[model samples]
Target chain A: MSTVREMLVELTGTPEFADGISDDADLSASGIDSGDLVRLVLLIEQRTGAEVTAEDMDQLTTIADYERFVATRGGAAAQPNGS
Target chain B: MWLTQLAERNRQCFPDRTALVDEHRSVTWAEFDDRTGRLARGLAGLGIRRGDRVAVLSLDRVEVMETYFALARLGALFVPLNHSLTPAEVTGIAQRTGAVAVIGEAALLDRHPDLPVRLRIAMESEEFAALGADGIALPELPDLPDDTPVAILHTSATTGQAKGVTVDHASFRAIALGWLAVARPADDMVLVNCCPLYHGSMVVSLTYMAAGATVVLMPGFKPQTALAAIEKHRATHIWLVPQMLRFLLQAKAMESTDLSTLREVLYGASPMPVDIYTEAAARLGCGFRQVYGMTEVGGPFVTLGPEEHPAPDAVPDLIPAGRVVPGMSARALDDKGEEAAPGTIGEIVVRGPGVMRGYWDDDEATAEITVDGWIRTGDLGYIDRGGLIHLVDRSKDLIIRAGQNVYPTEIERALRTHPAVHDAAVIGTPDPDYGEVPLAYVVADEGTGTAELLRHVAEQLAPYKRPRRIEFIDQVPRNPAGKIVKKLLRG
Candidate 1:
């Protein structure tokens, strides 16, 4: 099972795109566009059964924020593949 | 007296009333008018003049609306660039339009450093903020004629290039009056517009504002954000695409969202699935209006009003595109260019005061799409006995993914650029989420793989335009004249 960080990295289509990126960096500024953000939210929901609310979207501006969100929602723990 | 006077009239009538709202701030009608005047003067100080073309690229924001009104005040043509386009595509459009100036967000401007424009204004720069400063005097605004072109909206071409649709002040004014007559919006209407301001759908926002309604603009459409906005602002009306409506329906927020204030939901750009429409209508307890039109014509000349919507439990019938609005006329023409009888499917064409002036600088292409004064809609439809337009299919092989147009020829052209790709054909396949998604059939050289082709196309096209799946085929079936037979491929 891929971690939240791994899924975030995969969204960029290459690891180098997310490499050296700070946890506090704005994902939109770091090449994650609005479309990608929507797709990421959908992916997290499908994989972890976690709900990202409208309030959460306003605060989820950085990678660290998203990671913290998933962890709090009980999605950070690894599960079996295709679970 | 179309756009410029509309702003002035709003200020005069309701100075304290909120005119525009975005995530950052809300502006009153008076403040909005004052800002537009100052920005127009600032742009004039930078050498922008009447009749000059200026390209604007930005996400949905109050500044985008300000720039549009500012340019319209000066009688300059506002050319809105789709933010999703590659740098090369942006450059191509900027060059073709002979744009003299470009204004956009700092980040978006950074991506297109080589755009063929004499001046660039970053919306977030200190200079940009100073554009609306108090000291600069407002320039003498142009007294634009009704026929003066105000905007150039680009539509993806069948030939893989983009064509600019030139629309004049009169076209918009006609559309506004016609829509007002049909919609009869109340003075207290508060609308949450989900469509991006760059596209032709901006007309909806502009038209609502002309009637002194408050419009809330989102940077982009997120289902949760949209639902929250509707509740927060007590929005009386909302406009979005059908796919967006689907997302909003599925959003977790929908369960707790207060939607009692929503009076109407306007959807367009693509057909609304019957099941989704029925479910949404029942749940939201709001009327649904389906607007139908194209960029080549003005935004929307036909509408399926809420009264015309079928009962939820009734046997589902084909939902018509609706009756033509005031100031517009439509008919179906047979292959021989004669008007088809009622109930006969044929190429739908429309004539109206809102029809676009012409394609920018392409008389031949413009002539091809226009028959007499009517614009060919490229949709196959027929008028029923009740005078409603019922669409059967699209004559053009254009794929609409989630509300954005994805031209198959453009994708095919990008595929052919790959070294190993011999030939490619693309078609639209139905999807439960997005109305349709592109499926590609490829004839490639030995050892070529889907990943390689997908990567190559990714570099050339936007994310939405990319193919969902590629199937290796022996050959792309074509006629003796070398025209691709997409029907066979669909089978």
Candidate 2:
């Protein structure tokens, strides 16, 4: 199964994430807007069966933060490097 | 001499009062005054002179407003670039404005390296803060006429190219005071500004400041953050577009957030969805007002104050386009240019100091929109016996998706750029989340598919401006005049 990082990289379509996005990479600074965030939540929920609450979505500013959020809800354990 | 003078007056009158509070920090009226002054001196030090255009590109922040005031001090025009635009689009705007300098976030500068400007200042760098650091004396404010253009706001036109709205100090001053006269905001109101800095922030926040109220600035409107800011600041008033309010109401945080401090909720930009309006009014337990105006008219010139909004479920929809504010006159003109009888639908025409000087460098287009000192608002509405304007339809071929204006011609122009396309017509379809979203009907080459055409238009326009869906058609319907009959496309 594709890792969370892989899904994000694919969704963003930015090749900079080809090497795998860092756990701490700021998603908002990377141009992931609120609309994009809403889409990302749906993708994560579909892949991991993790329901990201609106409150959790507000706190997940960085990639690692979101990975941890999904893991807590029974998603795949984060592989920061997509190894 | 300029609108910034209000900031100066506020600094003296309420020196120790909180002027602006961002997520990072807060600045008092005195500091806000001093910082903007220093930044003006810094820009002047860069050899930027009066009448030079300075483009500012950034997400909503206090520095953006500071830059606005600083430019006003120097008599320079503020060109706010919508950050959603592509780099090429940004460059095009900068080139058109002939900007002497550009101040933006680091990522923006990196994205648009080709921006034609003599000076580029990165907001995150020490170079930016040093502009307002101590020891550099502030320069004297420029002596300019009230009609001196202070801001150039670009609004999308029917022609597909964005038309720049040149607003002068007189217009801002008039709109700010006139809004207060009409809206009658409570004394000592603390406002949380949740809308984008580029849009109604100036008219709303500045007007509150003019009334000696503290205006808290949100970097961007995330529903949770917006709620937190209001509760934390004990904010008494909040200004937002209906779309943002919808997000706030959907947020789970709304269930628990202490929004008791909120007294007045000002909503506009697009018509408020009745469901969202009713739900928000009940949930927040706050009085709601509807504002109706446009960027071309120097922000809001009409308001349906809280008293006018009926109790929830009192009517199918209680939304009113609002009545003209003091110093503004409105008349609904029929197709023959005569006044429409009361309650008869006609184009809403407005004449006021709030009207813009003219579209920047586009005389023909400016002439088209204005006639006899009255600006054609492009809105079809009727005035009731109560003098409240009720919007029945928008005659402008513009789609308002989530409060952002999307011109069909602009999207159609982008869709035609695809090599596999023949012709395209764009129309607005009703949406639940957004008031309306664009729907594109296309007659395309045999090989082209929906996904390919979608991606093609996405590349040329901002995300909000792109069509939500594309329908393949045999041919685009047009009249003998060769104009696409958009109404048929809607059918």
Candidate 3:
């Protein structure tokens, strides 16, 4: 299982995602299309052991918001190091 | 009002000047017009009639010149079939259009190809031998209206069955006039052409030749041969697709070749990125024009001006599809059929002389898009305050959720922006409750885990626009014409 940030980091293959970029950055405003976001949703489902319905897809607004949803929905617990 | 007017006017003005060149072969206006008159008679002798359809299928040769002009003279429709398409496809088009004759040389008949045309004949290798053997009286062209049907071009059938688009003399005249207003074909300029004669760009070039510039044609798009010809003949101009531009830009002698003779390069048939355009402009050393048009409307209705290229303001503004030339008008309309405000997304509607008469024999579909006289292009996008058209996607490919429109193009654009995503396609999937939701298929440049993707984009999109499902594929399914085949994915 991988953290939401880790999953985002993997699909985007950007180290900044792994390290962390602002969750509020506009994904489209940041240049991400719904296609890339869809891949991200699939990654969340696989890593977090969560069933993400298409209806559930709309509830997410930012990386932090998504991570919290995954956490509440029993997504992967973060690594031992808080950092 | 007539196709012959283009050549006739030019022949009167430049009769002794070479009007066409191919493989060291050149045809002057005087010779082309005089012989084409006889060839029209030859075709008429073989029963090609006014408003008849003649299908030309062969390697690029001198006879094609005679074929085009002969048909133009008689007001018969000329159907240029792609030599690269499968024989079955050829047969299907021939059957659908009910062509009067399918003319080929010895090589094209090698596979014992069967066509649904009324007659089939193979011309000799010399091409001109037919003229010497049987001298037929040149048939005087009949008086025909510009609105008269001149050609029946088949739609690419990228998504489904091919439909014939009726191009009238008005449409042809409008296209040539509008293009010349910008391309400004030089009478003495040697135009090197390699696109298949069936394609719209090739036909446009034919009109340019008909306008009197010497035409240098190729059998087909062959990169090596194109380079050789450019070098050997000093071809002054070339028309190509973006893919061809990329290749031409890479030719070994591109920079060093005595390209001083080269004057302009015309490219269309697909959307191109800004970077590619910039590179091509700098390297090719010619004015670049982007053409945008569909089969229903006379092609290339809009083009981005040459001044827009590689400029600082080119971003988002330099749409390769230039502004609509004079006489034609464009409006972006929403689903309800009302005009969209500037920068608002909607389907594009066009009206002008260039608009096709209608889809040949498909009245039901014709009535659906064409209303009054405006052709409703299923393409979705917006017009800026300056009146430039920006394409988003076909209206059929739109995904609606809770009454909100989610354009797949916007989503696909987002996906391509990702560092790892090489390509992406977003389509609407059936939703029991909401009626539909978007599903995305991605092709990635590198192996990546899903968690990182979720973290990066989960917060970036609105709830309705988000993709509920995702899948990775080796490559998107595209038809022979390189357009993504979403219908196949739904199947």
Instruction: Evaluate every candidate with DockQ and list the scores.
Output: 0.33, 0.14, 0.01
lDDT to native, each model: 0.85, 0.79, 0.67
Q: Which of the numbered candidates is closest to the native, going by highest DockQ?
A: 1
Comparison by DockQ, 2 against 3, better one: 2
Ordering by TM-score: 1, 2, 3
| Candidate 1, position B375, lDDT | 98
- Write out the backbone clash pairs for model 1: none
Q: After aligning candidate 1 to the native by TM-score, how far in Å is the CA of B461 from where it should be?
A: 1.0
Better of 1 and 3 by DockQ: 1
- Overlapping backbone residue pairs in candidate 1 total 0
Q: B324-418 in candidate 3: lDDT tens per residue?
A: 86768888887688888998998889999888888777887788878667898777788988877778766666665422346676566656667
CAPRI category for model 2 = incorrect
Which is superior by lDDT, 2 or 3?
2
**Number of colliding residue pairs in model 2:** 0
